[model samples]
Target: MIQASAGRDRIGRTARLGRLRVTKAGQALSEGVLVAVAVVAGVVVAVVAPAGIAVPAAHGAAAVSLLVRARTVAGRVGLRLTLSAISVAAGGLHYVLVDQMGAARHAAGVFPPVVRVLACVGIAACLGGAVAAMVMAATENGTTLIRLRRLLDGWLIAGSLFTVGWVLLLHRADRGGDGSASFLGLGRVVADILVFGLLVALRFCLPHAQRTATTVAVLALAALAAGDVLRILPSEPGAWDGIPLAAAGSLVGLFLVAVAPWLPGGVSVVGFNQRMMPVIGVVAAFVPVVFCALAIAAHTVAGGPIDTVMSALAGSVLLALGVRQGVIHADHLRITHESVVREDHYRTLVDRTSDVITIVSPDERVLYVSPAALWVYGYRPEDLVGARLPLYTHPDDRETLMQAVQILRQDAESDIRGPGRRVSCRVQGADGSWRHVESTINHHPDGLIFISRDVSERVAQQVQLEHLAFHDALTDLPNRALFADRVAHALRKRTTDEAPPVVLFMDLDGFKEVNDSAGHAAGDTVLRHAARRLRASVRAGDTVARLGGDEFAALLEWEAGAPPSSAKEVAERILTALTQPYPIGTMKAEVSASIGMAVAVPGITSDQLLHQADLAMYAAKAAGKGRIRLHHAEPPHAHRGTPNG
Candidate 1:
C-alpha cells in the first residue's frame, strides 16, 4: 500500500511539471502572435490603407488589443492599464472626429461647434495619456529624470520654432477672415504637430532597452501627424485624397502601439532621435534661410511689400545663425583631424621600431603583433597573431617562461604590483634558427604587453669573452686557471664508492732548445701539434691544459671499479706522442716529455694534487727524459718511474 501511494505521488509531480512547461511555451507563443498582429496591422496602414471608416476601426481595435496586453505586465500594472484605457478612448474619439469631419465636408453644419470642441478635447486627452504612459514605463525601467533634463535645450529650440510657425499661420488665417471650420482645422494641425514633437522627445529620453513599446507609440503619433498634414494640403480632383492615406497611417500606428505591451524587447527603430536629433537641429537652424528664400520668391512674383519686409527679417536672422553654425562645424572638423593625425603618428612610431611588441591574453594567446616582427623574427605580423606564445618558444625554456607568465597573470589579478617582469629565452624564428630574446612583460587590465628585443648576438659575444678568459691564447685549450677549476669540480663531485680522478703533469724535454735553435714561430707550431696529440690521447671527459711554456697537464675521469693501470697506460701514450717528430715550418724537429701522475683521493685538495704531480714530473726528469713517474703517499724516495726500455 505504501509503495502504491509513493507511485501515485511521483505521477502527480510529473504531471505538474509537464503542465508548467506547457504553460511557459503557450505564453511565449501568445506573445509572438500579438507582436505579429501589431506589425502586420501597422504595415497595412502605412502601405495600403485608404482614408475611410476602416482606418478608424483598425486603429480602435489595435488600441484595445494593447490595453488588454498591458494587464499582463507585473510592474505598475494599474498605471499601464489606466494609460492604455485612456489611449483607447482617445483613439475611439479620433475615429469619430474623422467621421464627423467627412460628414461636415459633405453637409454644412453637420459637425456642430460643441461636437468639434469635444473631439478636440478628446484628441488632446488621448495624446497626453499616451505620452504619460510611455514616460511612466520608461521611468519604471530605471531611467532617471536627470537624463531627461539634459535634452531641455533641444526641446526649447523645437518648441520656439513650432510656436512661431503656428502664430504665423494663425495670423494669416485671421487676416483672411477664415471661417470656424478653418480655425478648427488649424487647431487640429497644431495639436498633431505638438503631439509629434513631444513623442519624438520622449523616444529620445528613454533607454534603448525600454524603447520597443515607445517606438510603436511614436509611429502611431507620426501617422496621425501625417494624416493632419495630408488633410490640410489640396489634392488633384478624382485622385486618391489625403483623407484615406491619413486614416491608414493612423490605424497602422495605433495598432502597433496597442500590441507593444506583448512585443519582445529587441525591436529597434533604425533612425532614432539620438542620430536624427542633430539632423533635426541643423534643419531647424536653417529654417529662416528657407523661409527667406520663399518670401523673396513670392515678392518677386507678386510684388507685395509685406513679403519683402518678411524676407528682410528672415534674411537677417539667417545670417546670424548661419555664421554661428559654421564656426561650430569648423571647430569640430579641426579637432577631429588633429585626433586622427595624432593616432597615425603614434602608430607609425611603433611600426618602425626594431623591437617586436606583442599583446597577449591571459591564456598566453597572442592577440596582436606589431609590424616590426617582420624584421626581428622574419615573420609578418599576421603569422604570429592568434598563435600561442609557447609555440615559438624553445621546449626547454617554455616551463620557465610559463612560470613567469603565470606570475604576471597573478599580479594583474592581485593588489601586489611591481614593474614589468624581465625574462630571457630562446625563440625560434621563421628561418628555423633559435634567437635569444630578452622580453619584458607588462601586465595590463585588457591583456599583457610583451616588449622583446633580440639579444642573440650580444649573448654569443658574452660567451666568447668568458671562454677566452680561462683558455690558452695559442693552443685554444684550457689554461692553468680552468684546469685547476675542473679538478676542483671533479673532487667535489667524487663519491665514496666512485673512482677518484687522475691528474697527469708533463714538461717538454727539448722544447726550450727548439725555441733557441729554430725561430719562436717554429716552437709555436710544435706546441700546437703537441696540444692536439695530447687531446687525442685522453678521454673526451678529461680536461687538458697548458700551464705555461713547455708545461702541460691533464685531468682524467675514470669509471668506478676501473683498474689503476689505466692511468699509467694513458701517461705512457702521452709520452710516446710527445717523443714523436713534429713538423715545424717545412722542417723536422724532435721533442720528448717527462710526465708525472697523481690520483685525487678523499681529503686531498686540487692544489695538493697539482704539487704532487709537479714533484713526480721533476723526479721523471731527474731519472731520464722521455720517462713516466707516479707519485706515492710517502716521501720523494717512494716515487716510482718507468726507465727507457
Candidate 2:
C-alpha cells in the first residue's frame, strides 16, 4: 500500500514539472515569433519605401503597438507606455511636416518655428514619461523618506548632466549673438541629451527581465538624440547630410520602442533604491566638478572669459551636490548605529566560562585536573587526572601539543615555562566529541602547571559562520569567493612542465523558465539537484561551486603531461549528469548545462582564466545549449554529444 501511494505521488510530481516546463517553453516560442514578425515588417518597410516615407510609417506603427501594450499592462509601466505612444505619434507627425516643408522651401521660414515647437513638445513628453516611470517604479513599495531620496537622486543626475552640457556646448561667447533660432536649436539639443540620460536612469530602476527591453528602448532614444544633435552642429552648406541619418535613426528608435513591451518581465531589482541610490548620488556629485574644470580650462586657453551664467549654474549644481552628500552621511550614521545596537544584543546572549586548570608532568601526563573537567570535557576530575595527553588530544593535533610540551620542558630556567607560552589544539571529550582547547603552560618545581579552556562552542560558531560565507546556503556548494580562491591557488602551484589548470564556467539552460513557471522553491530544488550532480561528476580533488543563481563553476588541476582532453572528458560527464531529469516532489524537472573551459597559461591570472571560460560558456549557449566549449587565444573549440548514460 505504501509503495503504490509513493508511486502515484511520484507520477503526479513529474506531471506538474512537465507542465511547467512546457508552459514556459510555449511562452518563449510566442515571444520569438512576435520578434520575428516585427523584424520582417521593419526590413520590408525599409526596402520598399523611401527614407522619409519609411521613417514616419515606422513611427506610426510603433506608436500603435505601444498604445496596445499600455492597455495590457497597468500602473507606472502602462503610464510610461501610453505617454511614449503619444510622444512617438507626435514625432511621426513632426517628421512628416518637416519632410513636406523641405520639399517646399517657399514655406520654410514659417514651418521652422512650427517644426521646432512640435519637436520640443514631443521631446518634453518623452522625457517626462521616462522620469515619471523611473520614480514610480523605484518607489512603488518604498517609504516616504526613500521616495524622497530617490527623487533627489534622479534630479541630481539630471541637473548635473544638464549643467555640464550647457557649460561645455551651449554657453559660448562666440554664440552670444546667434539669435533665438540658434538658442532654441541648442536648447533642443540639451533637452534631447537630458531625455537620453533619464532613459538610462530608468533602465536600472526596472526589473532584470524588463531591462533588456529597457535597453532597446534606451538605444532608440540614443538614435533619435544622435540624429537631433547632428542637425544643429555647425557644418558647411550642403556638407552636412543629417536628414537621411535622422530618418534612419528615427525608424530604428520607433520600431524598438514599439516591440519593447512584447518582451517578458522578470524579477525587479531588490533593494535597488537603497543600494544604488547612494552610488548614483556619489557619481552625480562628481560630474559637475570634472566637467566644470575642463570647461574653464578650455575657455581660458581660447582667450574667453568664463560666463557669469555658467558659473552660477555650476554653483547651483555644487550646492545640490553638497546637500546630497549630507543626506548620504546621515543615512550612514543611522545604519552604523543600528549595527552597533545589534552587536551589543548578540554580545549579551553569549555565555561566559571559567578556565580549566591542570598540572602536567614533563612526560606529558596530566598529574592534576580541575573540577571544571566535567563541564568542559564531559569527564570527572578523577578520570582526567594521571591520563596521558595523547589519550585526550585529537589525533591530528597531538603533534602540536607534543611540540608545545617539548618547548616547555626544554626551557633554560626551571621557574619559567618558555616565556608564557600558549598553544591551541583539538581535545577529545569523554563522550567522543571534539572541543577546541586553548592551554597556557607554566613551570613548577614538581611539574608544569597548565590552564586550559574549552572554547568549542565559540570556535564552532566561528567555523560555521566562515563556512556560510564561502558556501552557498541552498546547495552547500563552495561559492564564487571560495572557488576563485582555489583557482588562484591552483594557478600559483602550476609548473612549467605540467598541463595548466582548467576553469569551467557553467550556466544552466531553461532554469529561469522553471523558476518563472514553478516558482522559486521549485527552482531551488532544481538547483540543489544540479549542484549534487555537478559534485559527483567532477574528480574528487577538483572543486565545484555554485557561482550564484543558475551559474556554476569548477576548477580542474592536472598532473604533469596530462592532456587537455582530460578536461573535455570531465565536462562531458558533467553535461550528462546535469541533463538528467530532476525529481522535485513527484514531478520531474529538466535543465541542461552549457559549459565553457579555459586552460591556464604560465602568466595568466585567475580572473582572466575565468573570463575566458565565461566567454566560451556564452558561446556554447549561443551555439545551442547542452554543449561544451574550450577557450583558446584565437577561437573557442566547441563539443556537443548525447551520451547513452
Candidate 3:
C-alpha cells in the first residue's frame, strides 16, 4: 500500500513540472501570433490602399481589435495598449473627416462653415490623442522620457528663434495682402511645427525592445513630415507635384497606430543614437543659414529696402542658431579636455605607487600589470601581462588561490556583492627567489583588481616576535610558558591505555660560583651547554625549556606499554651531561645539575606536575648535588635519590 501511494506522488510531481513548461511555451506562441497578424495587416494596407479611403477604414478596424485585445493584458501594459488604441482611433476619425471634406470641396468648389468646423474638430481630437499618448509614455518611463525631452527642447528652441525672426521680417510685406490668408498661413506653419515636433518626440520616447513598432511609427512620421514640408513650400497646394503624398502619410500613420496595441510590451527602448544628435543640431543650425543667404541673394538682385530688411531679420535668426550650436560645441570640447587631463593625472599616480596593481580577467588571465611590478617582483609589466594568475604563485599555494577565485566568481555570477578578499601567498620573482606577498582582490565588471604588496620583510619580523614570546633569549630554548602549554596539550589528548607523559626538572649546582669568578658571560656559556645537553638526551618528540637562571625543564611523551624506567634513564643521562665542564670564551667552567623526574597521571594538572618536579629537585639538592630524585605522592618515597645506590 505504501509503495502504491509513493508512485502516485511521484506522478503528481512530474505532472506539475510539465505544466509550468507548457504554460511558458503557450504564452510565447500567443504573443508570436498576435505580432504576425498585426504585421500582415499593416503590409496589406500599405501595399493595396496607399492613398485610398480604405486606408483609414482599415485603421479603424485595427483600433477596435486592439481595444478588445487590451483586456487580456494586465497592469501598466494594459494601460499603454488602451491609450495607444485611443490615439489610433482618433487618427482614423481625422483621416475619414478630412477625406470627406476634400470630396465636398472638390464637388462644390468650397466647404460649408459647418463642414470646416467639423474638420477642425477632428484635427483637434487627433492632436489631443497624440498629446495624451506622449504624457502616458513620459509618466510610465520618467528617466528616458526626460532625457529625450531635453534633447528635443534644444532643437526646438533653435528652430523657434529662427521662425520668430522670419515672421517679424515678413510681417511688413504681408500688410497689403488679404489679412485672413496671411493669418491662416501663419497658423498652418505653427500647427505643422507642433505636429512634427510631437512625432519626433514620440520616436525617441518609444522603447528599443519595440523595434518593429518603433520602425513603423518612425516611417509613418517621416512621411507625414515630408508631406507637411511639401504643402508649406509649394505655392499651389492642390496642384503640387506630390499631391497624394499627404494622403499616403495619413494612411500609414493611422494604420501603424492601430497596430501598436498588438506589439510586445515590457521591452526597454530607451537608447538614443548619440552620434546622430550633433549632426541633427548642425543641420538645424544650417537651415536658418541657408534661408538667410537666399534672402540676401534676393535683396542683392532685386534692390528693395523692404526685401533687405526682411533679409536682415532672417539673417538675425540664422546668426542666433549658429551661435547656439557653436556654444554647445565649445562646451563639449572643454569637457573632453578636462576629462583627458583628469585621466592623465590619475594614470601618473598609479604608475608612481609602490604597490603592484593588476587587473585579471574572469578566466584568471592577467589583463594589466602596473609599472610598480618591476620594483616589487623584479619583473617588467610585459612579463606578467597575459599570464595566468597561478603561473607566479607557489605550487603549494595555487590550489588555495584557485579555490578563492572560484568563490568570487560564483558570487559575481549570483549577483551577490561580497567584501574584498585578502590572501597571503608566496610569489616567485624574476631572480628565482620567492617573496611573500599580501594581495587584496576586488571584483569588477570586466575583471578583478589585485592590489598586491610585498610582505616578506613583515612576515620575517612577525616570526621573530612570535619566537621571542615563547622562548629563552640566551639559550634559544622553549621557556616555562611554552613548556607548561605542551604539558596541558598532552594531558588533554591522553587516553586510558596510554602511559602519561614525564616531566624532568633540573637545576645547575653551584652555578653562582662561575658567574662570580669568570663574570656573567661564563655563566651564560655554562647554561647554553646544559641546554644543548638536555636537548640531546631527550627523544625528538620531547620538549626542553630553560626555566630562568640555573634552572631548566624537559617534557617527554611515553608511548603506551612503555616501562616507567625509561623516565629514570633520561634523567640520569641529563645529570651526567650537565655535570661535565663547559668552555666559555678563553676560560673553562664546571657545573653539576640536580635532576628531578615526575610522571603525569590522569586528573593531574600541568601546574601540579611542575610543582612536584620542583619539590623533587629541591630534595635532590639537599640530599647532595649531582643526584637524580624521583617524585612520589608520599613524603618518604619523594626523597629517594637513586634506588639502592
- lDDT of every model, 2 decimals: 0.68, 0.69, 0.65
Q: Is candidate 1 or candidate 2 better by lDDT?
A: 2
Cα displacement (angstroms), candidate 2, residue 638, comes to 75
| Error at 115, model 2, angstroms | 6.1
* lDDT of candidate 1 over 453-548, digit per residue (tens): 999999999999999999999999999999999999999998877778999999999899899999899899999999999999998888999999
* Superposed Cα deviation of residue 473, candidate 1 (Å): 1.6
- Over 282-334, each residue of candidate 3 has an lDDT whose tens digit, in order, gives 45435545655665566557664555535555555555556555655665675
Question: Candidate 2 has what TM-score?
Answer: 0.44
Model 1: colliding residue pairs: 50-244, 51-244, 66-258
Which clashing pairs does model 2 show? 13-586, 13-587, 14-586, 14-587, 14-588
Instruction: Give candidate 1 regions above 4 Å deviation.
Output: 1-335, 415-417, 634-645
Which regions of candidate 2 fall more than 4 Å away from where they truly are? 1-51, 94-123, 143-149, 152-157, 167-188, 205-210, 234-243, 264-273, 276-292, 341-645
Q: What is the lDDT of candidate 3?
A: 0.65
Displacement of residue 131 (Cα, Å) in model 3 is 17
lDDT of 2 by residue, 342-399 (tens): 8877445422336777888777788877677778888888987788766578887777
Better of 1 and 2 by TM-score: 1
What ranges in model 3 sit over 4 Å off? 1-153, 156-336, 414-418, 633-645
Top candidate, metric lDDT: 2
RMSD of model 2, in Å?
31.7
**TM-scores, in order shown?**
0.50, 0.44, 0.55
- How do all the candidates rank in terms of TM-score, highest first? 3, 1, 2
